[model samples]
Target: MISLSLPSPAPPSFKPPNPNPKPHKPKTLKPSSSNPLHNRPIHHLDQAQLNKAISTLDLMSHHNSAADLLTYSLLLKSCIRFRNFELGKLLHKKLTNSGLELDSVLLNSLITLYSKSGDPVTASLVFEEMGERKRDLVSWSSLISCYANNDMEFEAIVKFIDMIELGFCPNEYSFCAVIKACSVKENVWIGKIILGFVIKSGFFDTDVCVGCALIDMFVNGGCDLESAKKVFDKMPERNAVTWTLMITRYMQMGQASDALELFLDMVVGGNAPDQFTFSGVISACAKLGMLSLGKQLHSQVIRLGLVSDVCVGCSLIDMYAKCMVDGTMVDSRRVFDGMSEHNVMSWTAIITGYVGTGGCDKEAIELFSEMICGQTIPNHFTFSAVLKACTNLSDLCLGEQVYTHAVKLGLASVNCVGNSLVSMYARCGWMENARKAFDILFEKNLVSYNAIVDGYAKNLDSDEAFKLYGQIEDTGFEVDIFTFASLLSGAASIGAIGVGTSKQLFKCLMK
Candidate 1:
């Protein structure tokens, strides 16, 4: 063995004063041979390769101080990208230990990370801490944005108000967030207030995003046509979304003719109709029963190759079904069957169309059953159409079966479904069932009571019918022509002369 020269320990007098002596200057980490970029910020690294690089760096004990701070922050960002909260927590600990947790950029990143990871509590905590530490606008905006995007609308609004109170002006992004929140809650009043703020902030004219949100808010809030038109007219610029909203607003207000006229103007204005615009035009045509105009629009749709669109196709089917012509129903069925994707609305349109034509009850029922067999769940509208068909046909068995199914689907409480049920039972000579349905109604409307009373009167049960009529009167329900007709008929059937003196009840019908 090589003789290891054991250097004698330093002489007793030569004391090693304070073995762990503090350096005059803080000892800075030198660049490691393993890492040439150790002194540089890790944010400069390719984010895609960050995970593997971080793992390798973890194994290496020697790392530059500044590089460690930067690398840990970048690594936290990567963890956020992957939504790996566990990894983020570990990196957070590292950042805290490295004295970078209070870093504004790092805290902002962490806030966004927690928000995106669906950890709003943590995001909120980090945000509060950031504010306590005097962070910048970006940090504030990040937390507000996270709250808004996370569907914490109330929280987001509070944060926005807080931000404003803090003398921090919101950017366009902040306005968009609050506007979207108002839109979601359908709080048009607040939305209008925000619009005023947006205008005062000078964000409305330059920001298309803010403009779009404003238009959406007005339209969705059931704003009047004049209000919507004013907004549209005043817009310095318009996009496809703006035109679509305007068309939709007209359609919703039952101004189908105006909607069609606007659509033509849009075409003349050289804005090509997108699928949504065509769908709106088609719906207007259907409502007007304007088969001729509807067909013209259909031609345009085909030319634009939008016939395959589910919404447009459904509208086309509806329009054709409403056509007064004999073979128009065939066209409706053709459109329906040809649809590559048939949702509940497709089936509903065809069934309602068949019911409207007065001899296709059997076909309507078959289509409804086929919808169920095709694994397409029937909605309230579907049941309503089928029930109407059953009422027209006086198919008691089918009507009751549909009622059972409606109950199974938890749609029996839907007003339309309940009305249809009462009508079907009354028309099918099941007065007891009709009364039961009427009784179960949470809201007893005049039409519903009238339905039951009229059923009894039609069946020549004047006494029972009169009792219901009295009940309706007791409830302060206004007697309409139908009510009077049913009452007069009931009294006349029973030879009660007093009912005839109730004022020219049948005069409207006579006229």
Candidate 2:
């Protein structure tokens, strides 16, 4: 949603003298002499420099002159790099008004600009405006990627088919985009058909990117992990991205051990792991509670100069927190402190670690406040962690404030946040608030029932607790040990029950 304000293009006009025009020069503007602007350092320009460049264009228009294709292309590059749609729109207006004929290269850039800006209809119009001679492979590929990246999977697939029927040879980029579309639509059949085409076209042998796309296709289209592994095992070459992809998929499937083993293989194969690779492996260490292994990996991260990466830093923080030795969060805090930047994930990890460590609830709450003050919005996990801290400190006042924040964000009805709110209110001896939070939950699980029932039982409201127990039975929920323990506690508080009542309770428990 980046926006830039510039003057609208006017019809051809003569130059007019400005009495007090400010002197402005764009700094470090080093566009190369041959085919300058489009491929140069215009992307590095700040707002003021970009304004100066546009002002130069304004001066051109004042002289009834149109900027050449190179100038327009460079400005378009700057606009795309900054995601400034308005500036691009202005460029389009000027380009249209100019008598210059659109070349395929400039048209391709326009297609890409519109596509990446999430305006596929305009992209389609631009594509349609091109003659058959002007529609090159890059033009087709850009359109396919636009559709695939913007959730138009069906259109992407159809366009791939159309491109093939039109006698255009599909390249690696084309295969990757179409395969991604198939993956999104769960069209494994079409993906495998494309795999055959890939092999026949020799892209599978020459381009590792095509192979990687196939692996992702099979993995995301509900195929087994072994299918993805088969593609991985047969690749002619593997880059850090390819290795990281497999490792990450393994982690997503809950096979952390398998992911770790693959990382070892990746290293042994002389492949260098990137920040994402290190992050995935460190997460494996965290899951297995391998503190020593995690520390070794941390050393590797520091050596590789990736310790400053936000993702790697977050993963290290989480690993050290989960692998706390002697109940000390010193390692986790040290990692958090050393991080150059903090995103919501990093902030949540540190706050959660402090909450899980004993006697650090106040510290956790303070960190949460700091996160808010830094303009980092808290997610459901963040709210849950701070609410747990509130419960531990018996700070109902702070808990209520946190709940208000969650409500404002509309996360109060989210399952994890709602469950945490109920637990916090119940523990704080506010059954009414607890019940209100419970009722608004979009869906409830056993934990929700247990929290309210336990609250009533502990408060010696045996009648309400028993009624909730009946409702639980009517709903066909299998009563767990917690329910039995709470009901027994309630019964004991009201003195011994008669034989018939005891028999009925035992019967329900057996069921």
Candidate 3:
């Protein structure tokens, strides 16, 4: 016994157990279907997991009623989240057939799904069905918001009025929707009424959304700068949107100095200008023809990493084009060539810049041709600019080609494009062609008629020109001073002045 004890003590001092140990059996994670913990739907899952769950659910046989309503609702929500309209519709039909349509949460989810699907018709139908049952503010707001977001502002405003008539006091979201609709309409009177309601309802002081919308309403309502300033001044807090809207208001009013002052105020107030802010200020500079200010803003834009922004870059080009100094076209071309991504506005800006600087007609024509060859669809403004270039270059051939293009594109009827085409042909001494264009126009405005008449007069076709002047008078158009002057000059050149024509010319001069 003594020897055994001595050996045990010596062994304990000299040896350690085996360094490597066997891993415990991973407790054979029980099958999810069998384990209560695993059977429950995962909570706080990320977007990916939720998506995966939706896919898995979709893979399951449609006959599986074992999938609860909550699971279906969650899948529908995920479909909305991912904007998978087809899957959303499928889930929605299933939920409806399952008699869960009356479920307030499920119904709300369906409304949201339809809204996100861009099928506002279906959303409206669902909303109507909800009205036949128990309804809540969420239901009303969802339908109203869908209408507003989809640019059915008139419908949304009407619905808001209906909602109020139904005795439902609008929440902040409802007010925001109504205000946004008013803003879209540019109805300052309606906006003021809405603002009063917002204030009397005490929503403006508490809700940032209402405040923001109020600001937008004033600014977009044709430079209600005073009201905009009032809203801005009264707000206890202002975000980037508020500041941007104020800056934009000034810019839109052609008040560049005011815009710059506001920009400086924003800086002093510690609000960093975003791309929109910079774009607005740059536009103000463009309107004012302030190249120096535009350049300074451009430098700030580079520092703010917004130089590449399409809108800001376009504004910068426009600003340079509007400068009184020489080399504006060079600066505009430089900006245009430097752009990495080109959209219609990018090309349009450069073309407009060329048009602004006299005798860039060739460059403008080349750019328009390039744009067409690149398969970029030209808009009405594009056609107008190209026609102007044709006029400047006296390229009757090019003008006819552009006219054909405009007719094919169904843009020939647009007043501005039509006017430009008439002027183009007139300037090129193509009076007959100008007359043809005028006749084809659906409705001739004073400008179009005047352009054709002026063209004939300039070409010394006094007979044709006088006939057009009589036609203009017969069409209930009051000839302006320019028209009278043109007619007088044509009569003087052809020695065909009549007493009637002389009296009309005198009256026009008096006018």
Residue 494 lDDT (model 3): 77
Query: For every model shown, what is its TM-score relative to the native structure?
Result: 0.66, 0.75, 0.73
Top of the candidates by TM-score: 2
How well does candidate 2 match the true structure in TM-score terms?
0.75
lDDT of 2 by residue, 174-196 (tens): 99999999885467888888889
Which digits, one per residue and each the tens of the lDDT, describe model 3 over residues 294-381? Answer: 7877777776667888998899888888884865488888888888888888888889889878888898989998998988888888
In model 1, the worst 10-residue window by lDDT is 1-10
| Tens digits of lDDT, candidate 1, 44-143 | 3353555555555544435442435556666777778777777677667656655443678788888888878788888888877765556677777778
lDDT of each: 0.75, 0.83, 0.76
Clashes of each: 0, 0, 0
Model 2 bad stretches (over 4 Å): 1-48, 97-100, 131-133, 377-381, 391-397, 403-511
Query: Cα RMSD to native, each candidate?
Result: 19.1, 11.6, 15.2
With candidate 2 superimposed using the best TM-score fit, by how many Å does residue 61's alpha carbon deviate from the native? 0.7
Model 3 / residue 502 / CA error / Å: 6.5
83 in model 3: Cα distance from truth in Å? Answer: 6.7
Q: List the residue pairs that clash in candidate 1.
A: none
In candidate 3, which residue ranges exceed 4 Å CA deviation? 1-122, 132-134, 146-155, 184-187, 219-223, 373-375, 400-416, 429-511
What lDDT is obtained when candidate 1 is compared to the true structure?
0.75
